[model samples]
Target: MTGRLSMGSGQPIKLAERRVFSDSFKPLYNEGMSLVERAAEYLDGPGRVEARKLSRMAATLYAAESMRLTTRLMQIASWLLLQRAANSGEMTRDQVASEKSKVRLDTASAPDNAIGWNELPEAFLALVNNSLSLQNLVRLMDEEIYGRNAGMTDMPPPRRSNPVSDQISLLNTAFARG
Candidate 1:
């Protein structure tokens, strides 16, 4: 989970094929849930107070950023829950992966210099930063556990037919051979 998995001889396994059933996944789940709870408590308590003191533009930006933060956390929480379900045997890997596909990992915060961004409390900012870090970790793990893709390169390409073009090409090949 640190970065690589290895065989008994220590040659690294392919990352895309890595599985999430290891004990290592538990720490990630704990950290993710902890962050989600902390973010929620802060937003509902001190964060509300902090937002009230911001200037008009900063307050507006704060509202928007808060929405983004909440949405991001929800997505992270969903992914963590699914991963836990898979780890706990509550759900099969295939079911978890299917549900995981619906969880979005692309949410991002505003630029540091965005309007009123500097006015946000440092604690709130820290939460945002931490959540982003967790999101990235989850995304990497998802790819590793699920295989980066379906490994479809071996499948035959889709056929495209143009009867006239095929006939002309056939004629060309025959004549050229002669």
Candidate 2:
């Protein structure tokens, strides 16, 4: 039998913050809708199930990434606004660096099998990458709007997946046992 468990008070779990502002170039979400619409046009009834799954995946990844970038951008923008309001004269370098630290863009490695290296449609990897890049650009532009460095942004970490290797290793172990 399943029952709910209550824990004594402890440090609260930290939830990721969500951004409230809407940006103009919302590519990830808009493109997902487009993909869903296109797929729906070609499919019917049960066939739509697979298409819907793809669309949902696309939209979810897009939203997750967009939210990350948007949050960063908002922080940066707010910092800039605060600086402008408080400063009676030009800002110093150290002041700028401190504010910039709040919006640090950390690179994350992607799954290797994210997309086939050489293939059309390319497992939707291109779409994912493109969406991420656009998200970064949006953040960068916000920084630029506030008169910050728009140069030499770090590249995203490579994406890799090992499902094939994992499956093969499992098969080899099974065969050896047999």
Candidate 3:
């Protein structure tokens, strides 16, 4: 899935747009969107009730954790949306690439041992953990597809002067560039 596609013809994938349209990307898109919806539901419903029970210090921590979880999910959703746009031809790959620069894929979670970490509800913690995992997966998949450097230009190798240099060597021995 990370590399070129092959259907037994043994050729490298030539269509650049295939990065978004590939079959492997579909499941990831679905998973990310599902997580986003679930997180929103939990935060607005049961999460509000659970937060009221927290001690002052733990309540503060819960607020921070919820923010992080929301931020992480939003970023993942943004990326997935961009890819979906490309998949459906709503936007060109070039447009997606330009817009993608704003999507941050390096979100991180607070340490498990942080002061009030143990006070968080198990369900809330589970959602945070799941979002973190999905974020990491999306980041890796993005890196594999787009590469480590954004807007990376895969320039072809410099052409060789062997033929010209050979001719030159034949005519004049010491001045060849190859």
Name the 10 consecutive residues with the lowest summed lDDT in model 2.
13-22
Question: Per-residue alpha-carbon lDDT of model 2 for 1-178, expressed as tens digits?
Answer: 1122334776332111111122322343354344434333433443334334544333333333334334433443444343443342355545654665555443332343332222213334444464445445434543443334433256444332565643443344435432
Top-down lDDT ranking: 3, 1, 2
Residue-pair clashes, model 3: 0
Q: lDDT tens string, model 1, 18-78?
A: 4457677677778888998999999999999988998876776677667778988898899
Candidate 3 clashes between residue pairs 3 or more apart in a chain or in different chains: none
Stretches > 4 Å off in candidate 2: 1-54, 72-89, 107-178
For candidate 3, give the lDDT of residue 122.
96
Best by TM-score: 1
Ranking by TM-score: 1, 3, 2
Error of 3 at 36 (Å): 0.9
What value does the lDDT take at residue 51 in candidate 3? 93
Better of 2 and 3 by TM-score: 3
All predictions: root-mean-square deviation over Cα? 17.0, 18.5, 19.4
Model 3 Cα lDDT, one tens digit per residue, 18-123: 6458776688888889999989999999999999998865676677678778998998999999999888889987898889888887665656665567999999
C-alpha RMSD (angstroms) for model 3: 19.4
1 or 3, greater by TM-score: 1
How badly does each model clash, as a count of residue pairs? 0, 8, 0
